[model samples]
Target: MTVTERVRPGVDAGRLMEHITALAAIGATPDGGVTRLAFSPEDVEGRAYVARLMAEAGLAVRVDPAGNLIGTRPGIDPGAATLVLGSHIDTVVNGGAYDGAYGVLAAIEVARTLAERGVRLACGLAVVAFCDEEGGHGTMGMLGAHGFAGALPPGIAKVLDERGVPVGDLLAAVGGDAERLPEAAWAPGDIAAYLELHVEQGDVLERRGVPIGVVESIAGRVNVSVTVEGVAGHAGTTSMDHRSDALVAAARVVLAVRAIAAEEGVVLRATTGTCSVGPGMWNVIPGRVRLGVEFRDVSADRLDAALARLAGAAGEIAAADGVTVTVEPGARTTPVACDPRLRDLVAGAARERGLDCHHLPSGAGHDAQIVARVAPIGMIFVPSEGGISHAPGEHTAPHHLVWGADVLLSAVLRFDEAPVARG
Candidate 1:
């Protein structure tokens, strides 16, 4: 096959776009975005639309007990492992159109092209639509991914959605049997490999003028909550030097989070995303404050070093401010490196298409990381306009989206066309 033909390989660009536009309309936002939060009515509608697309692509579709949608194209050899392609369809509040949706729709287009051409693989092709990838407004993020990995939390049945309704109930509303969630778990060999396509959600590719990124690793993330407590006093009556203020201490802790990272030349990014202060009234001096500090890095050692430095900083800040500071660590997940062979296939496809390919680590967490527990994983990234995501401005050009699919299809074909080995 000619290089151009191999790269494009009959992917219907217009049809691919049709799917994107249609899905974007389901949870349409007035400011040009979407909000199909997990388990929301809008999310149900969005998944239904994808199910229709999957069916039209000639795949047998079903929803797993954990609410993961799987559409499978039968293989030439029934005993062979399945090659899975996927991305979540749910979006964050006011999220842009292409974040998780592009990867999914693009995979369907690839499947449609393969089916129309009558090409069936030894390894069956399955497309997954993982639910709650954004964590359903913080009620346990990556729920579907954890479910598929058979790593779901024990308390899942008791977890509630944003509206205080049981998540299990919401899953049922979308055809999921929460009681049978274990049935969704795929054994180690069941999924031979997992591939995902997504927008970069950062500016690296765009700033470097690269259209495609071969993910080297998904960064490990750790979050810690720091609380500072002091005596509350009247804003007008208390002397600034004699009175204790938790907000002031918390602000210092927030700045120290960044200062430590920068001064130590720490590889991880440290952010204080939230600061809760009470009493909140303007006339009341704040007596308690909590700050959420999160750190992300490709190296676990680096993350540990960061935490150690944070502890020392907190001690100094607490003593200086005359307040008690406590640091409580939250979730900590190690980084997942992309499979070496698959990484090369994606890179080769990008080069074959004459697209500039860059290798980078993913800062944002994705389903691919969790799925890595059961199968080898790979990821492709198209440039996010200005590295924007989870907001109204998230964008990738029409052609960029198609090119990512082309690379995804080419990589899948390369893997399928090669000789197979079994343990």
Candidate 2:
């Protein structure tokens, strides 16, 4: 019941900003963003840097086969489980700073605060930085946490990347022993709960004039790859009526996707992020095309129906154009509702800090979604300027960052005393 604001052991806003600034320089893009791919040399170095930071804070560090970094501070009671806090560090090509970095920094502040206060929980505490949440290497997104949770399949060790290099090989080189379970370093029962602090990748908080958004659920995401194939013909000689243009067929499907969302009367969204047309030259008629379609919604069933409609539309369009169409389901992850107890804890922290807070659903995917499956999970969101993310223009002012850290500090303290376990 005690709510007091004091400088937690290592909760230095200036120091946290310094860490973010230094990490940004590692994969520093020419356009003021970062481009470090997961499990690459750059990621290896970045992981090492974070490990060093954790070590200096007097935490023991270890890396699992899935490349997750876990830093633990032992508490007085060894029988109780540990509290885990983290987000992935790998970024999309040219991604912003606060997305994944803020969570790790906030966890570090938690460790610093606990150390300074000389407050030991009944259980241990761990700070983790998961690897490759972006799926940049074509491996499983949230692979690190998935492995830790025993959700990773046994055979995924041999999955190859774009360069035909096996994941097992890569993991071995990075000091992770690929055994029966990729995350042999830790088991599912070790973590009592997990929490992530991140920037709201949308304008939700700013639009509502709130400082913090307690996530209710992480939206489900599904990707469909649609391929349209039509017979090639001479561009100039073939009559418009006789020609079977794959590009034309693909365009119709794209329009249908947009139309489906508009007609559904639901909060559903679909996007074609990538497109490929064959025959490269302007004068050549396209014979084949590939489009990447991704759909997201708060409801999993609604997302399924929308994807089904999209597939049906693609089939109809291809039939009309005399083309062969194929739809392949790619990445699929369901929405995760935050642990209610932790959600209330976050709201209480915001209220104690005299900040406006609202309960919101996260539209973007995060490592916390994966962690929630194994541990009780909560998220604290800071407002994003103009709701921009995944770009160089993504911005969160320093004050927001500091405030978020303070809220995170309070939540950790609450969890430390009255532990909640999932069924």
Candidate 3:
């Protein structure tokens, strides 16, 4: 049957916006943004508020060992494999109201609407609020989703929460057991599929005048830290021909990064967002320079090739400047392709609702990427005003937010009705 002909539950725009407004107020910034770092007292309070909402939606709520908040609404068949919907609530410092908040809050609205209208389906529904998806700490980012995928990186043991609390205490504060974090992984088939709704976080949808984006893939990323060493000398006295300048060599490497991403036929993205130079003096030559470079693409093979070329370029530049350079690789995550069936389902939902739909690849990373390892994952995106995100200026129109949630509601019902939902 066509999506339009099927019985569907509708999302309440007023209620959804009210939830967004309330959550935004928890870690409200003076400049109309939010800063609820994961496990911070503010974040904990936000989670409690969401927990109350989940309970009010008539779902049984609990926190997993990895600090993922989950609320379940049972299906008619007690043993049905669940269909999961959610996104993280933790925001980057000074982030806007929508990035991850809309997904989790909207998932709650879906369950609440279903309960309020007495709608039931064959597949159980689960709503999750994942932890720490936007952290900047080394190895501490994407902590919750990785754990939920049963692949938590080992470095988390050395990390501290936003409040400087140890992992054990932080988990305990949220009713999670750090020692049992490994148990957070669900065996295969426990979750039939995963779906997330998020802001476009880029200008694609807005630029194209499309209200929705059906994500094709989340990019695989490789980050490297490069340190260039050279002899410090008096800038004025040193002969230009004989001097080895670290900054000069580092500058070349940065240029190479830009060139690689912008070059013809190169599908990979490269960036050097952070750089540090030592011996800061107008008359003194730089002795050491440190750079943070990253490469991202949907193809792991392409990422590998781009990074290899970068290393070659760095070595050549260092040799030309008589300096030594070392590249230290950092956290790497492979690209994740969305399930074709689910992608079509999202597109169909948008079409049925008369919202313009665009298909695109996510340049930024997401929890849906990690969750893809265990379940078929799909993502729906709404436009971000001016393509801004992870900052105070980020925004999506109120109508766009409602459209994403409404499309999500339609998609969830479509999933439950599919023949493959049986346990």
Candidate 4:
């Protein structure tokens, strides 16, 4: 069937916007942004509000051991694998309103629309609000989704936030038992598919004038902490030939990092977002420098190759500048491709709605990547105003938000009608 023929009026844009506005108000900052860090009081309150919304949508609500909020609407076949739709609600510090919250709200709108229409399908529907996706309070990010996928690390309980509070305690506060977090993991047959609607978080969609982006893959990430050491000396008295300036060497490494990514093409990205210099003084030469280097790409092979080249170049630069450099690896996540079947489904839905669809790769990490381990996963992206996100200025127009939600609704219905595969 043609996409246009399948189109139907679904989500109420006005009601959806109201939900978004009310949720944004929970952690509203003085600067007009949000601060709903995961497991914070504001986060808990926001979850409570979402729970009320779930109840209003006629779904059974529950919090999993991993602190994931799940709202389920049963289908005709009780034993069928379930269709899950959701995203995280937690935001980064002073983050924008739509980053993660939009996806969760969109899922709820889909369920509400289905319930209101009395539409029943073969597979059950589950709307989830994943916790701690924004790396709240120094905790490992994507905590809830990772736990659900059984990919959470072994030492999660021992992990502490900025407040010295263990993640276990935080989980307990939110009705989750860190000791029982293992029980939250879902087996292969538990979920039929997963869907998420999010803002593009980049300028690609906006620059291209496309209303929707059907994600092709979520890029892998590698983070490294680099420290360069050199002898401190008086800036004015030290001759250029006698100086081993750490900052100078660090700057060379940063430039090299950027050049390498540029050589590798658009799929590869490298960044040095943080830099620290010791003995901050105008007259003193820098003795030590620390840089936080990050690399991202859709191909694991390409990411590894880039990291190797970067490390080699850093060593060369350090040797040339007479400085000692140390590189320490941090968090690393593999790249993940969306299910081809599901990707096409999203594209078809957008076409049916008469919206311009663009295929793109996500540069940012997402909960859908973690869930992809167990189920076929797909993502829908709406344009962020001026390609801004993770800040107060981040926004997707009201109509764009509604359009993405409508696409999500269409995709969910299509999944429900498909035949289920069971082990």
Can you give the lDDT of residue 318 in candidate 1?
A: 87
Candidate 4: the clashing residue pairs are: 3-352
Per-prediction TM-score, please?
0.96, 0.93, 0.95, 0.96
What local lDDT does model 3 show for residue 220? 92
| Clashing pairs in model 3, backbone N/Cα/C closer than 3 A | none
lDDT of 3 by residue, 48-115 (tens): 99999999999999999988999998899988888999998998889889988889999999889878
lDDT by residue for model 1 (201-264), tens = 9999989999999999999989999999988989999998887899998888988899766766
- Across residues 154-263, which tens digit of lDDT does each residue of candidate 2 receive? 68778888788887776775566667454343555777888899999999899988999899888998888999999777888999999889999999888877776776
Go through the candidates in order and give each one's C-alpha lDDT.
Answer: 0.87, 0.81, 0.86, 0.89
- Highest lDDT: which candidate? 4
Error of 3 at 264 (Å): 4.2
Q: What is the lDDT for 362 in model 3?
A: 95
Ranking by lDDT: 4, 1, 3, 2
Q: How high is the lDDT of residue 177 in model 1?
A: 86
Instruction: List residue ranges in candidate 4 displaced over 4 A.
Output: 1-7, 263-267, 419-423
